[model samples]
Target: MKKTILIVEDEDILREIVKDYLLNGGYEVLEAADGNEALSLFEEHEVHLVILDIMLPEVDGWSVCRRIRKSSNVPIIMLTARSDEDDTLLGFELGADDYVTKPYSPQILLARVKRLIESRYSTKHRKAAEDALASCGIDVHFPSRTVRLDGEMIRLTHTEFEILTYLMQNPGIIITREQLIMKVWGYEFTGDDRTVNSHIRNLRHKLGMKANLIVTVIRSGYKFEAKR
Candidate 1:
């Protein structure tokens, strides 16, 4: 799919020039003569990036940038005729990804657009791959009290979950059954090691092929070990 760039410039010739360069670069271009049109177009389409001019009628570029930042993290490059430092600073504070002064080469602007879009997409894809790998082995989310094994969700009872969470937290250290009951069921409980044994059996069953991650010590109890 082609990436879309919204060009919000009030100047007719500049807009046409930038749009031509972007189009030739194999990107889909959207033209907005002013800030109001820019906002409207942004709301209507899937705009991957924005090229905004600071001077406009109805609304200024800064206001447009502020409004876009409230909803989207889409890359934005602000264009201005003035090379004022304050304007550049304000654009950055408003979340503009890049800034270009007037008379910039159309080819240079296109290069900036390509870099910003590539950067945003690369970061998104990297994060996605990391998230997927997070579930590849035994993955636990403590806040949600959920566990995933080999990319599949495993349902566990409250006690079973607590037992698994504990072993996982202390991987490579064998935990005695008495210690497990004391921690999971609390010190006040009177249950024996059989109680811990029952929960472990069911937890291992739910874990399927990954059950070897929980290794049993001969005279002691069990510990979690990551697959080599």
Candidate 2:
């Protein structure tokens, strides 16, 4: 089935441009002029991804994204004219999967949309397989996508689970950011290294100090170091 994308931009021209580009790319596209309308449409449709502009009439994209994260893990890519680092970090903190600056190439945006859709679906498949793996205390089970601490179950997002699984599967072997991005994100992430760091922070936040199962390998990468 073709993935559905919701484009939320108050500018009529940009909205139509994105819609047309996505439609040409073989995706089902939905458009909303503001955050309120976008949220309503989001609630009504089975959208696979969201392209949200930061500035909106009813509500801003950041708030919209926070609200959405409250309920779903659907991939969101924020659009903004401001290139402020703080804004970008804030977006990531709110669970946006990616970001694109304004005056952006439509083709680049379309490519990002395609990648997000593909990654989300691919991760779903990986999760199903990972859900069956065996994980001992503070251990990761790659094939089953399971995490266990002291023989208890732990919940992780698809991205976090994938990253941990990769690390554990290669136990004691350090993997670079590029490799981790390819494995967990399903694409060559050209963005800052902080993307990986931010996700790791999130994984740690969820796993707590028990997450020492994953060790930062200083300037090289991360590894799943089983405690002796």
Candidate 3:
């Protein structure tokens, strides 16, 4: 079955262009001119991915992204005219899977959409290799995608979970920001090192006392050290 992609943009021309390209790329496309309509379509359809514009009528894209993230981990790629690094970081912080600045090539957008969808679906059937990783009073369970520190369950976002899992999987080894981006967000990801730093910061805060397990290595990256 062809995967469905939701395109939410207030700009009619841009929305049509994206819809055309995605349809050409063999995806079933749904179009929404505003955030409210986008959310309505999202709730009604089995959308596999979303291409959302930050500025929209009624509700904004950030609100839409946050609303969707509250329940579904559906892949979202944000489209914004803003070139500011802060905007990009904010989009990621809001649980967006990717971001594309305005004047972006439709082909590149389609490629990112395809990559994210593929990555999301490919992992859906993966069985847990090692069910759990326990160290320093923190336990991470792969099957349930849950984490516990000192026997208290900790809530982590999808990105945070992946970052922690990757670090825990390679204890004592220095994992660079670039490596984390590639592994956690996939090789197609184009964000800078700040993205990794942001997630690491959030992960550490959530880890609390166990946060020290993720040690920063000066200019390099970070290492997860299990308590001896």
Clashes of each: 0, 7, 0
lDDT (Cα, tens digit) per residue for candidate 1, span 1-228: 899999999999989999999999999999999999999999999999999999999999999999997777677888999877667767755666567888788987887787766644544333333332232287875544457876676755445666787887787899988787666644343334544566677678888888888888988989988666
- Model 2, which residues run further than 4 Å from truth? 123-131, 137-158, 185-190
After TM-score superposition, the amount by which residue 156's alpha carbon in candidate 3 deviates from its true location, in angstroms, is 4.4
TM-score for candidate 1, residues paired by index: 0.56
Tell me the lDDT of candidate 1.
0.77
RMSD of 1: 19.5
lDDT of 3 by residue, 165-187 (tens): 89988999999887888787665
| TM-score against native, each model | 0.56, 0.83, 0.82
Tell me each candidate's RMSD, in Å, in order: 19.5, 3.4, 2.9
Can you write out model 2's per-residue Cα lDDT over 1-228, one digit (the tens) per residue? 888999999999989988999999999988999889999999999988999999998899999999988877778889999988778878877878787888889998988787767655654444555444433356565544456766776766556666777776787888988789877666556568776788788877777766787789888988877676
- Candidates arranged by lDDT, highest first: 3, 2, 1
Off by over 4 Å in 1: 123-228
